[model samples]
Target chain A: MSTALSQKLDAVSGNASGGHRVNPGELDLSHKVILYLDGISVSFDGFKALNDLSLTIDAGELRAIIGPNGAGKTTMMDVITGKTRPDSGTAFFGQSLDLTRMNEPEIAHAGIGRKFQKPTIFEQLTVFENLELAMKTDKRVWKSLFAQLASDERDRVADTLQRIRLVDEADRLAGLLSHGQKQWLEIGMLLMQEPRLLLLDEPVAGMTDEETERTAELFVSLAGKHSLVVVEHDMAFVEALGGKVTVLHEGAVLAEGDLATVQNDARVIEVYLGR
Target chain B: MRTPLSVRMFQSLPRTAWLALAIFAAIAWIAIPAAHLLLPESSPFHVSAYTVTLLGKILCYAVVAVAMDLIWGYAGILSLGHGVFFALGGYAFGMYLMRQIGTDGSYGVALPDFMVFLDWKALPWFWVGSDSFLWALIMVVAVPGLLAFVFGWFAFRSRIKGVYFSIITQALTYATMLLFFRNETGFGGNNGFTDFKRILGYDITSPQMRLVLFGLSAALLIAVLILGRYLVTSKFGRVLAAIRDAESRVRFIGYQPTQYKLAIWTLSAVLCALAGALYVPQVGIINPSEMSPANSIEIAVWVAVGGRGTLIGGVIGAFIVNLAKSFFTVSFPDYWLFFLGFLFIGVTLFLPDGVVGLWRKLRGKRAIEDTDTPTETPADAKGASA
Candidate 1:
């Protein structure tokens, strides 16, 4: 598996000389690790947002990262998604593509999809269109000008609408959707991308209890098919995710284990969950 | 699956839209020209040259309005400097018209009167191929398209958007206007280019030429409407609207908003340039004032008044506003500016969706389900901030 991964990386680096067509989204998860960040450090205007943040997510792993405010959960996601460049360290998708070198669109095309803390769907477009735009396809300007949805693509969109439970609201303007529906629609958009890694920030922030449970179930079902990294403040929702929980504090990992184990850690209690 | 371009273009508009276009084409190509040329001067149906020129001029303005709408309305990039592209196109074509004068100028020195007056020995480097009609046509699209491409590339890459983008565009045109006003610029100084004798060896001032130019303007407007309709309905247009609403979101979704914005921005500029090229021959004048910031702002007003995002709205808006301008300027010249100011204010407050939206409401029909209306979307809260 590692040999296959190295060959892929070799071909990627030698692409100019080899004159090979570089197909995106063919991420090398042969080593069973979908992501890697080692000694990553980022500072903003003299303030360190992330310091020596090292983390890894194995393929098909479901992990929840929780921390107090300004603990760098979002900053980590930003670094991973190429929104914020790190001052130092190595961040890799699979084993070859450097996260630090790529831009947002490049990173996204590399099979990493992020759902912001606030649902950021295209509000002016219809609900179905939001998913369509997010679909994994040739998104070039000239191509999009004449793009017509293939039967399979349309079926996928319809399928995503059902999974996200927005089938009824598919035709409605996204702006008119309720908050929970918008969240689902956004998730549906992510699903349409068929990403390898899903970084969800506060996915259940404003959802009702039932909606929150449904979202939890959806995330659980998505875990084996896609690696999930969720950053959330809701302990109940995190507990419902039922996965290895990582505690972040002051821009670095403080504790990492099962939710119960992390909850019992003294340092985690001191920095986050208190007596 | 991609459909053939010709098939897609033909099917872009509805049958009703096609019918409307056919009627408009009949009037412009057959009726108006016949009235101007075939009818006797004493006949009521006789269309005077002034009326034909005025209508031709409005048709040109309508094209500008649609081009403005393509960028500002659908893409949400309000450029208050489209006048530069329009004027640049005018200057490029106007150069050809000036050269067509040969030695018929006041000095008869084989040079344009302005160049002779400035005591210039030869044509400037930029005017080397001014005599070639094909070269002028190429320059008409190339100059504005290149400028727009480069300008849009830099501006969009830096993520300049919203009101800031609007301000810079205004500044761009204002600066261009000032530069053109200089005697050293070689574009006929403040007077610009005028006093054309012929085009392609045919007398330009003849009734035949006027009708030809007028017909061409009408044809261009129809073509623009069809093209604009094709664009806004395409998946590409949906992406444009999406970027307008949430640019950062678009970036995260694996689509480079800069490319889309730049493509549309440059295309819009080229469209405006085409309109400007048609405008110069019909109006018989191209001056530095055409690039004024105020003129650019007026183009936005036409799009706004017509109801943006709907291509047809731009045509209606241009006719309505320019026709009103002609009337008010002739009758109550002093009050025209004030009236215009009030018109804009009133439209912003009461007719937020412009005349088309109001018409939709009055008819008890919803706006074309697909027409993107800024006010109706809750998108402003997020609005291209990233």
Candidate 2:
């Protein structure tokens, strides 16, 4: 009945969509880099959360960032996802699109999705509905009112439910799910967005060993199709992911190598492990 | 081949819901009107004029309750400024009613008595088109819709939410009430608009006109329910629920919470304004007091008493509370406010999900027991907690 939102959306899509469109051509990863952060520094109340931090992720790479508390891991995710603006930094998605210039929804629309540290699935909604809400589609206010689930879209939800091992629990409210199930549901929701890069913060914090192993397998399998930047504190899960581990300390990278190599580094051992 | 519009509309509601609607329509459109207009005064089936007017007023309230539920229940936005929208609609239509008084006012002038009494030379610019019924109808929607859109745009854009949003809305209505109470604003001052003589060249107080307003109110409530049902059942509804639960999660999934919230908020306001327009013709008064913060709070109470997310709950709640109000104010006028306070407290304390949720829980438990399976225990537990 009201075209107010449609008009605003028209203005937004007209004014902001040009530079931020997610067309594959503009997402050019010919250099093989999916994410690039250079000289990023963020300070709050004069305490540096991130100082001169720079990192790069190869296309479709699963990058595990291991850091102690206050290592700027979450802040880094915030910056890339456009939640927090860094005081100084150039963050790029692929090569053409700038992450710092967009808002959270814009960054998400541009193919970057972030999962919070805690499991943040829509608890009141059924697992199926949660996935449906998160599914990649025209999310405009007016369009959503008449949107019917296409057969292919329904199949996509079913496929995701199977992949996330929540097929049996599809009808159940997500709040009723166990902690690990909620974690998986949140991941399934992220996958529904079809994000090019997935930033997961401590995704396996409360999972059982079996669930943790399963999640690790899922993340490993997801690599090469979806670039994952998993910020995890669980050493075992990180080891299970078996990807490149970047150890962060004092707001900067302390070590960069395989898990074995980082574990063996003298400085890494002194600051994080040797203690 | 696309489905026919009528067939699709019919299929929107389940058979049971349709039956319920049919029963309601029969009473509102056929039974009650027949009882009032056709039955002799001595007949037991004869409905009194006072009762018809009261029921008509409640029906108007029912429309407002449903609108409140759409935003507060479904969108998780608690707006205490909704009375402003309702009052705005009433005033918009009231202007037309005043103009229709023609040269019959005590001042014997073509201008409304208030304008003549205030020594105003002519109608205000805002009331220029107030003589046309079509203009009144347009203003009924446009006025509140515009206000809500502007207010909601700024509020939602700044991400003001939860209790803060509620407080701001309360302030909004309170301020509007104060503004309307001023004579300088040219809206009849504290007396507001009343003593209407006619509408569309027909007697406003005639039995036929009263029944017409009553039936229109019922139709509006029914339409609001159907539209609300269609909305909350769509993907948009699911996204709204998701936004309610986890707004940031919705943002990360690429949906702007502000746009969705603003759209629903404005729609809810427009619905309330329509209810108010219908309300003025039946109750025969439109005043600044209609925009009072307390009146808006009572609306939330109706939704909460019925169940927030369930559209039917708001209607049931409006009927329950208003009927109770009619009884209490007549019998114990002084304690009516106390009774309302206690009712709200009781509903909030013991019935968090409102009456509809309680009904669902009772039914769910019975079904669970009938099936009797260990796998259903979690669902049973969820019902209890929910």
Candidate 3:
């Protein structure tokens, strides 16, 4: 299983591979907004999880959502991806498509991919098949009957494998991989779909320190090219993601700023850290 | 324990294996009939009286087994109304057989012996043209297919799932059983249709005709098993498997599961009906008893006992269970029910996937757990830099 030419990044600059160190002042955010959530509220059995929560993510922006347990972070991901329809709200994708009206599969087809707290790569398939199957959706009886990956598809798959750093293990069954490898494989699966927006829930929750550091590096590289909304509780991982942070308390945004600015905010401390 | 023979066979030259299956089927088709014709009646290769009847019944069961595996093993649908589908097919074919017996019936008149015995004036509107084998064959396929479509449409659209769905299917079969039991239904009132004269003008009593039907059944069984195996390996097969593990996840990946579920479900029912159509003639009777709730439940136990999700395992399961059934009923009539119950419990507890599943679990689990590797998360700096 050789690496594909397209997704392979050039050699690491001394220390970091695929790590593109960015200067904050160079960010150009005047582009069109890709995702807009307005006046959305959801309740489960009389418990309000999202109360009039509205937020926007411009194309290529990586937004971090940090909150305590049950602050509606996961629920928010569900609403956007169409897993759970909000009771009332307006969620738009690319300034037009009414997301609230669409179902999960429709939203997925419309280009929003989500990775759950636990990685869910197909365990029975090989790593290469995991990515290849993710890219294929022509599930007709005959089409599936004669499925064979094209040459460019082969190249793209090889490229994705190298990008995920699993090119050497392409033929290996995914279930045989480590927990962190499983997580990466699932992320790779989501990438194969080429989603415009990604909703990742606790992507680094259960990983070794090294795996966590590597994941932080991966998210940093993924942010601008694809608008990403990452929900995590790890402060160090958050520091690695250096950008505007939205601190959630109960079901609404308590504070939004740079990591240092939000950490020092009295209200943020009162609800989150609680001196 | 290394790599299962079937998986290795499928992996090495898949097209060649398919060719082999086709060639084997062709040989069986010609050789069995030819052996019965050319070889002496006492020859070992010649089809025997006992073997002919047994093979016909086994063929019918094979069709039903394939249908069950399609829904339960592939589409993640566990149906308990398959017996009803089979009976509907039998009744369709039975009507033709009853018509064939016309004027030669017990009372010796133009009425079915049951209608004559029950003192009916004329044929029921539904029974009209059942005298034609062509019409009966069409009904045999159509009735079960239509019922399945309507049932699956409502069940799938509403998104009923899990054990709840299985219970509902059981209830449907139970209801149909009650409907067909009444004396007023004109379906022979418990003592179902028998004493057939002919089918399509061929003497039903002939040993040669019996041998032909048996050969057809054996060949059909082998063919359906091959088709089932092919289906579960394809991309659509992956979708169905994904649906089984996580429906919401698969739906998020852009597959409307209802359509796929319903399509496979209806196909399973139709196959069961075809099996039933073939079954009634060889078994020498067609009755409402075939639609019993208990019978359908038994089929599930058969599949579970064989191992689930592996297509061919269901066939082995059916043959073993039913073969044991015939022996137990004759040898130890009082212990048959208890023996089956114990077998079901044992399989569920120790071999949840069936025999093949148990074997796969032991072998595949070791292979998967023995190796470990590092995670492959991309360590790029693009997102961190922002």
Candidate 4:
């Protein structure tokens, strides 16, 4: 079983060939697009949460998604992370791995990490243990039971503590950390996996001005090494990231361009100011 | 240089925990047995057979409480059907005990007296190898483990949780109890399996046999406590606790929540079965009543009252509740159920952390005082304040 799983991981890590066929773990990013969603629609009982949404994210690009409430900002992230299945669409990681065919953990294992809107760290565990859990290790039950942190893994956790500015609070329970600290810890957890792409929902929703600026710096630093798709209501935070922006209205992309251009778009203004 | 075995064992647990376990082992293995067997009946120091049996019974219950804690307390899967697993284990062992009766039964036939009474001609197909003590041991673990695996696989795969999960487990045990009560199901109807003559060829009621069983029960409890401690402290245990706290977060971190729940659920069932296997020989009876939904709910109360997450708390809870049960059932038999209900309510409201949590809070306060220099108040003190 372990061998079979390792073989599958190997397939995922190997170079992906150009193909239209759906492969479980293959990702061909030679075309530069890391995530491709075309003609996607999702509904709840007759209400359309996402309607005919199409978006593409380029490799190593940090893209921010902005929209009014119920604009399907959260829904789009849900569809990408396999939290919610679209009724009809083709969603792919790179060009081959089908996102629709995968589950949440499988999507994550395929190297897409998601940070929820709320800061969701394991409150009972120490800050170090929380990061340790998110580290890219074998997640099988028996393997985890006997697993001891290698020196390098320990060093990585320590490094994350310093990076998140929680070095002094490393041993403290995560629940005891202040709200901003918990958000940083969650972001730090996502970073530990060294994910190929990250989907963060409201990354700076509840941070002070200084913390928000630091977070903006952190995301900027992470941009080229990892592709990031950030969804936020904070227009200033999005401007700080300085990325190409997509605005969604009623589950469809209404505007797409640089942040300044999208902000001034007629539909974007109508949805924001008109409401 | 390689570490010595003694050092390694010590490192696995704290020095104080080891000392406590050693003391318990000495009492169970040497002192208790000596008092029961060596001391004269007239002597005040004599430990009666009744006391030994009762303690053994409570030890089995303690093991069950610990197993329940593993799933409910740590994994956040409150299984109200744990009694099903416990009773299945008891019935498995009880089958072998029944077969051991052989010609000694009331009917003096190859079949158990129940079969003769029912006018049945042959043993049921399910009882084929049940006469073998080894097979009984295997079934004691396997039956409950398999049931839990299958049940958890389906329920967890579908993502059933919280009170809904609890309701389904209660229903499962309720259904099993009803099935066992039917005579055609071949579990001896409501009377279940009883009237044991021997186990491994020794008279079941002999002092030597009873003492042996009592000693084994104590040893198993300690072993389970140690095993439970090791597991909860491991990374796997950390993940289980994480699932309890935030299951969706666990999934987002690339863990299949179902798989973790199923693994722990199956393990917890196996532990309950082992406890049940020990229980039958000392209690000398196994009945469908053992699988009643109320009994399983009581198992949760024991863990909750003792402190859910603490491994030692489960053991302590089992002993405390059952000891009270023995006294109340005898002294004030009619009010015992009401008393139990009140105790559960009291623990839920006033002692949410159980006895262990209470102890920790007190110790935390004392430690703060001993420091003499006050810095920031501890997190536990904050909890106490709240």
Candidate 5:
């Protein structure tokens, strides 16, 4: 199992142009963890969704969390983002940032951005305006009253459009976008927020192969710049993402290794693959 | 008819054009007072004192309606007792006017005519120092502001919103009306404080005074509308709409909505009070009946009848409703209330957005169709299997 983890790392080391790439060295894992989670528990009506679980991600690391349905993956994301505060535990960001002490918006302002299972864009606003608004920029009364998008601000918007690859469709209404496009726009909004940490829930839940590939391209490009924690059920997409894959089962880390080792593990096969 | 051509031209024009038109209307309003001052005394288009006074009264109502819109249309707080605030301001101003009358009153006593008629020995405690115009102006702004603050603090803190908030506000106005109706309260009871002698030493019935009052009211109405626009277009206004659309979400967005709600509520009250201060001397009365809950509810009708979210619409609605009211009461006095009730029902049901909203729909340009789209982008199906 250790070899499996190191072997994936070794491949990325060997080929600068590695395929099915999982970079063990792109992120400085030796750096003190940015987000720390330990002994976190949440229950809904006596059912323990997140039991005594613990995890940590280094600053700028892209860690993908994979689990079957009912594995408490969504709840874990909820706990980190402050949507659902744990019944008990210490969830911290950086050295002294106690996430448990904050609320959702505070958490968002504290540099954690969450993309929910469903997109919640301001439907009334246009696509570009939605992204601009999400930047949470120009919060001043004067800026809003004057309402002239400055030249640099306009350039930043254009840059974000290019990064999201929605520059062509910047003028299109967000509602008019295709499902894949909407998902990309939502991701674009989160990206424009320029969060230090991003918790993306099921980002590839329903994507065409082309879109999925492009999203993989997008995430791969983003890995070194921002610490990404993606919770998804798609193993193939996960493999495409190529990171330290943590397989969560019944609210605990059942296995942590490359997919081949986890796939062949008897326990993981029974709990997740059902083989 | 050439109506369709004009309508098409209007529809095809940009939002800037619409804003330009509103600006022109305000300039024209200021022009009226200028004409009264400078134009020949008997020129046909030159405004008469009576006409100016009547228009001034309409302008005062427009200010009140704008205040109503600030709360109801923007904040989603429907205050059904706004008339209480307006009346409170009027009575405050009236107190000063009363004191100005002094020994010139019908009874020729130090106290108001009603007080001397009732055989009062001295001035009431609340009536002290009300003779100063400066003090009266302070009371005009403060009385309503403080009351709204107290009322809003309790009601909003309790988390009582929607129709319940509306009903409680109505009850507040009704109770105040009954309280002021009693003669022993020293507010002239049912007679409601009339026989004004002077406003800042100018003869109350002087035509020049009436014209000046008209200009003041018109200027104020224009100022409030401009202020309302500035406020509604700000980030604060976006948060207000967010509160209106989803309060919980606003909290999640890192803002405590109560402060925002209270600020706008107090602002609306102050505006209404200013309107009342302008309203009283022009109309020549400051009666307790002004506090009637029905009048407050009618303010809501004005906001709805014009266009709730649009501030200028509220002013237009107030002007149209009252003009219709004047025309209707004179022509068919028996059915005025019936006409108003049905008018409100028809607007709410059919228009939903109000007349300005309907007009925007017709115009099509700058129409913000808020709810016609679905969200939650579905990830590509192939990506899911991948």
Candidate 6:
């Protein structure tokens, strides 16, 4: 047991040599798809939240999922992140890891990071501590109890602070940040894990126009390095992402293509973006 | 080189806290014992035996309160069954104390008086090692710690939390209390373990012995406080607070909440057990009444009244409420319950942060007024939110 743990620790530390960003130890992306879901269905009290929802996100590809209220956008994110178990279907990450078999933390440990619709950073902790808590270090009880942040880990956190534009507010309590700032801090927290796949739920729900544009830019920049599945209601933000868009009407995909292509689709127009 | 444990333990605390702790240790270890043992009986400054025992008992309770704060205040697990752990600790030590009676008991048999009264022929399998002080000390921590670990494992794995968790814990202690009340349980039934003659061959009721026990209790309380402080301020403590605030969020960030909760829960139970073990010797009795659900709720009340999250607040709260209880139970025994109820309600409603928070607030306001600086408003706002 001791040898097994030490070997696991050695593997993790070996991967850490690349930089502060945790390399998830070479994901088996030979299948070309980072995430694949087919015939996924989740029902709550006989009401289908996701029904036969089949979608695949390619490696390092950015995808936007847009839909009306109760259209299963958040449910899809939940299913992908292992928050909600699909009643029937296959959800795979990196061809081998069955996401359906995993729990939330396991899914997260499998290099899938998620941002909740509501900014849920630790409000009681400082902005720096918030990012520090999210760092890709040992999550075991004893390890965390004795673990100190290495200089590289500190540098990574400092870098994330600048990326999230919260450098000035690093020492401030996270609860005191503006709504837009809180959103960025939460994103920064996700980035600290150095996930292979990022699932964002309504990244710009309450952001101002400028904030929304900046978030779009952030997503665009993160796309090639990280697979991003951005679910949003803002059309301009989707266009700004300049990626394939998947539209959902009920629990299934209504249309799939670019923003203009989806906008022009008749079924998409009839159920959503009414002409 | 890795930092020493001593430095790491005191890293989060200011220098004044260290000084305060040192002063407290000096008083507890030296001054109080000196007053009780060395000072002239006619001297008003001399500490009385009753006072020593009372303070000693309260110190044990303070340790329990500190334990309570760790799980409830930091980990967001409200266990109302902590009395089970405390009583378990007491029973473990009580077994040794009962053995120390050593043919001096009522029936003058090898067995305890209660066992002889029940016509028990021999010690139960569970009581095999009860005669050894070392074994009893091990039981004091292990029994409660093991129970907590098993209970927390099942409860946390099933994701039982919030008021449901609280209710189940209450049920746990309630059931244990009922079980311990039965004569067949071999725990002295309702009377539990008492009538001790000696501990380690020292006269059990000696003033010097009492002072030694008192000193041990005080030292344990201080140790627990420092340990609790170290834990709550470490990275582990930060994650614990995060779990308290948002459990699901912690899960999404790749942390197993159950493990964290279970670890702290077990640790807290062990602390409570240690407190209990110390308590039995000073108080001279261990009974099923300690496992009563009401007793466990009182433990929560001490943490709540003291200020839950602040480590020191727990010790302070334990001292304040127990002191009040000691005073009121004697002065107005009939109205003591009413006073305690009012105190709990008052703290919950008006002083949500407890006495510690109230102190900080007054000092904060005074500092702000004295400085008359506008820049301090943001800092105050941040403090208030945290």
- Least accurate stretch of 10 residues (summed lDDT) in model 2 chain A? A1-10
Q: If chain B of candidate 3 is superposed on the true chain B, what is its TM-score? A: 0.85
Please provide, for model 4 over B230-263, each residue's C-alpha lDDT reduced to its tens digit, 9 standing for 90 to 100. 6776678889988988889999889888998899
lDDT of 5 by residue, B1-386 (tens): 11232332343234674686577566545677677767887887787766677778888998999999988888889999999999998999989988888799877778888988888999989888798899999999999999999989888877789999999999999999999999999898988988887988889888677777877887787678667765664446655765676565344334456777888898999999999998998888888889988899899999989988788788879988998998899899999999999999999999877878888899885555322111112111222332
Of 4 and 6, the candidate ranking higher by DockQ: 4
Model 5: residue B148 alpha-carbon error in angstroms: 4.5
Candidate 6 on A161-274: residue-level lDDT in tens? 999998999877788899999999999999998888999988888899999999999999999878999998888999999999999877998899999989999888888646
Model 4 per-residue lDDT at A197: 93
**What TM-score does chain B alone reach in each candidate, compared with the true chain B?**
0.95, 0.93, 0.85, 0.92, 0.87, 0.93
For model 6, the docking class works out as acceptable
Interface RMSD in Å per candidate, to 1 decimal?
Answer: 4.9, 6.2, 7.8, 7.0, 9.1, 6.2
DockQ of each: 0.48, 0.49, 0.26, 0.48, 0.13, 0.45
* Sliding window of 10 residues with minimal summed lDDT for model 5 chain A: A22-31
lDDT per residue, candidate 4, A147-242, as tens digits?
665555667888998999999998777888999999999999998876789999998888999999999999999998689999998888999999
TM-score of chain A of each: 0.90, 0.90, 0.85, 0.92, 0.84, 0.90
Show model 5 residue runs off by greater than 4 Å: A1-31, A43-50, A66-78, A136-148, A168-178, A204-207, A245-275, B1-51, B71-81, B112-129, B146-192, B235-263, B287-292, B364-366, B369-386
Q: Model 3, range A171-262, lDDT digits (tens) per residue?
A: 78877898888888878888887777888888887888988898888888988778788899999998888767887776777788788998
User: Model 6 Cα displacement at B149 (Å)?
Assistant: 0.7
Each model's TM-score, in the order given? 0.93, 0.92, 0.85, 0.93, 0.77, 0.93
RMSD of each: 5.8, 6.3, 8.7, 5.4, 10.4, 5.5
Q: CA lDDT of each candidate? A: 0.88, 0.86, 0.75, 0.86, 0.76, 0.86
Best by the DockQ measure: 2
User: Model 1, range B1-386, lDDT digits (tens) per residue?
Assistant: 34467766776777788999999999999999999999999999999999999999999999999999998888999999999999999999999999999989999877899999999999989999999999999999999999999999999999998899999999999999999999999998899988888999999999999999999999999999988888887789889989988998899989999999999999999999999999999899999999998899999889889898888888999999999999999999999889888989999999988999899889987664455332222222322331
Q: After superposition, which runs of candidate 1 have C-alpha atoms over 4 Å from their true positions?
A: A1-26, A273-275, B367-369, B372-386
Stretch of 10 with least lDDT, candidate 6 chain A: A17-26
Ten residues in a row with the worst lDDT in model 3 chain A?
Answer: A5-14
Could you give candidate 2's per-residue lDDT for residues A1-275 as a string of tens digits? Answer: 12343343334334442444344424656566889999999999999999999999997899999988999999999999999999997999877888888899888877788888999988877888889888887789988876655556768899999999999998777888999999999999999988889999999988999999999999999999789999998988898999999988878888999999999899988887565
Locate the minimum summed-lDDT window of 10 residues in model 4 chain A. A13-22
lDDT of 6 by residue, B1-386 (tens): 34556756765565788899999999999999999989998999999999999999999999999999999988878999999999999999999999888999888788998888888899999999998999999999899999999999999999998999999999999999999999999999999988888999899999999999999998898889888877887778889888877788899989999999998999999999999999999999999999998899888899888787877878899899899999998899999889889999999999888888788788774211110112223323433443
